[model samples]
Target: MIKVKVSLRPIVSKINLPTVVKTTILPGDSIESLFIATQVGEIFYIGNGGIRTFLDIRPRIIKLGGSSGGYDERGLLGLAFHPEFYYNGLFYLHYSVAGTQGPVAFSESFKPNPCDPKTLNQRWINRETQYDHIDTVEEWSLQSNGQPQKRRTLLNLRRPFLNHNGVNSLNFSPETGKLVLTTGDGGAAYDPFNLSQDNMEIAGKIIEMDVVKNTFINNPPVVTRFNELPAPIQETLTVMAKGVRNIPGISFQRFYNQYIKYVGNVGQDLVESIFSFVHYKPIPVTQLVQASLMNSEPNQEGFVNFGWRGWEGGFPTSTKGGCSENPTLDEKTIAYYNEAVNTSVSRLKPLTSYFHKDQRPDKFGGTALTGVQAYMGNGIPDLTGSVVFSDLARVEESRSPVRGVLAYTRVRTDGKLNDFSVIETDYNFGSQSAYYVSLGTNLDQTKLYLGVYGSMKVTDCNQGTVFEIVP
Candidate 1:
């Protein structure tokens, strides 16, 4: 057993369900500022040597949940920066709103009251049926002072329910120059609506969109809405990659001549997995589909389905069935299993599996595996090419190696995962469960940020925390 030593430093505590900490550089700045977001709809930053509010959409968030909603899985979820941020003062955000709005047009004054309790705090609650309808991707341009000024609505996801509606792993790869969208299997247990396997639905999928060529000139940052996009782009965005329960952890690695994108998809009852795709170029979805179509291929083959309801740790016998919304469509696993390994298709397999039971006998930890990043910095050579990530779970502070927060593994050239180890095991992150964890950036990409989502995995206005991990 290889023992790993690390440290977790406190950057800011008492955050309100901190989901992600994003960093970007501006011109004439000695260092980049870190933008932190809470599930309650607040965006703040540590820049210009001071902490300030970058943007706040709390007033507009529908069904804005807190502990009262039993630890809502929604709210302001992820953020990103333009590649040329120093040149263009722009960034992007992903947040959920009441589907009751039903993918409406963007309005400058469209703020509406949501899940009214007249106030927000620890005791907040909203029904999955009540608050979640449409989750959106938005672009914002900053004023000269580094605060957001204007907003543009990009992709609008008119979702099915609230649970798992939180979008994450929002990233801008300098290599691809496009925004990668990570969505969950459209809420409810077992992907109730079958959104994950729907070719036109954007749930439980990995989607990419071009940001340079698609927006309004006066508005600044470009966008391609889900409905308005070309067929190829839309098809690329949704291939019905059934079985992707919810992919939260995602990061990119560009080695000598290969660009590897790593993702950790969380399973419902048993399996937790990490998989990678070698996407060197920002390939058009249309082309991949066109080629497959020209060759007469099944969409399932090209996309990997990790078997959400169909397969689990104890899959064959003790498997959980499909979601409640459409049970008949997912009745049994005969066709599902055949679809997963269908020979005519180009199915992707997991590098390794973290079975709930021992997570494959060599797995490090279990449950709520949120995000993964392949160590790309030279500061830590041993960690290079290794996948580093955090989990979402509440554990006894005394349980070392984190009862369920952070861990890492190495990927051999053959795509097999090496030994897994817990990071910062000696440190106590919080009694709260981690809703999300991601890599952070400084002058160098040498640290990771753990956003303690708070107890019960919900955002408690006063209980959430954000911690910084260092070598």
Candidate 2:
């Protein structure tokens, strides 16, 4: 059996409003690099492989909105090394820029020149620079060995919303030399026009493209929907999957044929879930909503639809759902109800979900199943192939007796979701909090390095800290 332990370290502390967090060991090198996307700055790179330190890279300022360059939710939000990182000094990044305009028409979206003054958005009228953003993914040149390189945008994104601009989680499927990216819904809140569910637009979809060839998986129709172009712009972009909301972390199984796990942070109202999208299935099926619920009585059977606006984490001030005589007034609640009833039409659900402290924290979010896998491909002592997750404690808010600790379950190779193991981290792990745990290769390698970053207010402080769980 593969034994795993957690190690806690304060890589960085008191850093408020941290976004995308990614970890990658240098290719063919032992240097581990942790990339963090923040709102205050562009991107921050921290190394803990051979040494321990943090490095920040602020890219050249690009005009946003339609004029001069500025920052908002628009900054470097994603970072990834090319599959052949050793060969191509090329790496990819995604950032939003101004100097651009939109709603011009959807089909001919990418046509407006970000530099054109007349084409800028009305919001950029006074900026003297472009108001629209030119978000792109570029390839960079790395130094000899696996050192950081000078970046160049390979693909640019011109998203509608300033927030939910989306981050790129790149993974190379060896089975197919395709690079897969799971992007969040195009905006921070609800997508009214359904840019995410729209098959034509690339804004809110999980896309699959050939990084080796730098092209789309399938050719899509060319027609402008929200751009100023007289005609549609010809483009080659493919959408492999659709309907996802705010996913920052995605990892492929170490075993070639296993499933790909997606750890995402959802917006308020809905529950955040860890999705295991199996690649080899006839249709990639996943499990959602696994957390348990607490009962007011010994056996009270009731259902609580998380009211995003009315009640956050179950306090009930009348924000999200059916609180007033009319529940439809709550936009999020209406959206949730419409979605849940239309399961046939919706692909969104939480394999595991949790309730607020009032509802019950002891039942769900107590523990979840997770793990590190050691594929038997090359045939080594494969000790890393197993399930592991965090155990929940009532540190932050313990309403009733702890029914069960947070337990992360795993679906075995037979495609059965079963209870695996639980981890006890002496922390509250407040509502919707998640941990990104890495079980390194072996003893000679590193065992497990678990770190967490998310919104956790309510304490004396207004912000939260990113911490490593020490075993």
Candidate 3:
């Protein structure tokens, strides 16, 4: 048996709604690089035990103080460093914004005229009833010693409803130097618009773009609903794969000849899971894959679709059913999804998934399952090959018991994942509330860091925190 013990140790403290965090160490760096994305829309750079403003986009983030109040999904959601960040100083952030104009369309409906409540009941939703947001990816470049300048827009997606827009997660291929991004099927229960299954829309799929060129490495995803949508929007998205659900974080596992990417996807009600996509170079070498050329774009390689909204189980054999957490499962839709599962040409099952069963811990109710990462750091021998992940449960309000999870799975082979287990389950931080949202490897890939969105909030001091998982 592969034995391991997990503990959370504080690294960076007092952050605001800490959501996405990343760390890196280059060959020429004197100090390790630590960067974090806050739900309130600020990316901070920490080093030598201090926090510095890497970039403050708070002014642009759209946070609607409604019935949900401070608890929200809108804000900066993802952060990533260019593969060559050390030399290029380029990075990207995923965030949400209010539409400057009125409602754009049905898929992304909205008219933010709070100043004039008279202009209401415009469309399918009332301005007061729904607060809409547009998810955006902005690229920025940091010079030798100056402010991080916004380079250009990489992705802008329209998000309807309040939550479940999916937790935006971004990472660059260690081997190919390409950007791999996972987006939640557009929000609203049952995916009312059916966007997750629609390939034409980038709303519910995994997309790959050539960040340097700011263009898709390939054409728009050839999804089932290709013919339904307007040709213009169809041509806009560059999908890498389809049938993806809510994925909050992803981690890379690389060997001498193989580059494997793992993404932890959250299920509706019954289960939560982790899936992987692998890319292999034709010729295996001692070193990693050589940055290759592709169809008119840089490093444009393809990946197999890890089926979502339809399929599950490389371990449980095969699991199926409803798309959302909604209790009612449409017979027709369920049948169609089962058919798709049987006939899917490119469906890949999950690495592991935990079901809500009797005798399971209350925390097993994964209202939100966020990150899945294999421990590749050499610092801890026991964790070297272990797959680590996190969960954010909405059912656990700030006061009832504890919140979320930060756990790991044991990988059995080079490809498949079997044992679904937990590393740390006891969570009680006293006046300091403990919740897990983001998981990442710091510089040198030796330590695992967990982003804490909340820990008891004391007067004059906010308890947003980020922690390192030590074995």
lDDT scores in order:
0.57, 0.39, 0.59
TM per candidate: 0.76, 0.58, 0.75
Give the lDDT ranking, best first. 3, 1, 2
Best candidate per TM-score, number?
1
* Candidate 1 residue-wise lDDT at 87: 82
| Tens digits of per-residue lDDT for model 3, 164-222 | 65554777767667666678766544344445654444666666655655343222222
| Candidate 2, run of 10 with poorest lDDT | 282-291
Residue-by-residue lDDT tens digits, candidate 1, 395-432 = 34455333445677766777655456666445554453
TM-score of 3: 0.75
Q: Across residues 26-132, which tens digit of lDDT does each residue of candidate 2 receive?
A: 55656546655443334555654332333344434343323223324455555565667656656665555433544322222221122333322212122223223
Candidate 1 whole-model C-alpha lDDT, 0 to 1: 0.57
lDDT of 2 at 87: 62
The alpha-carbon deviation from the true structure for residue 241 of candidate 3, after best TM-score superposition, in angstroms, is: 1.6
Q: Is 2 or 3 the stronger prediction by lDDT?
A: 3
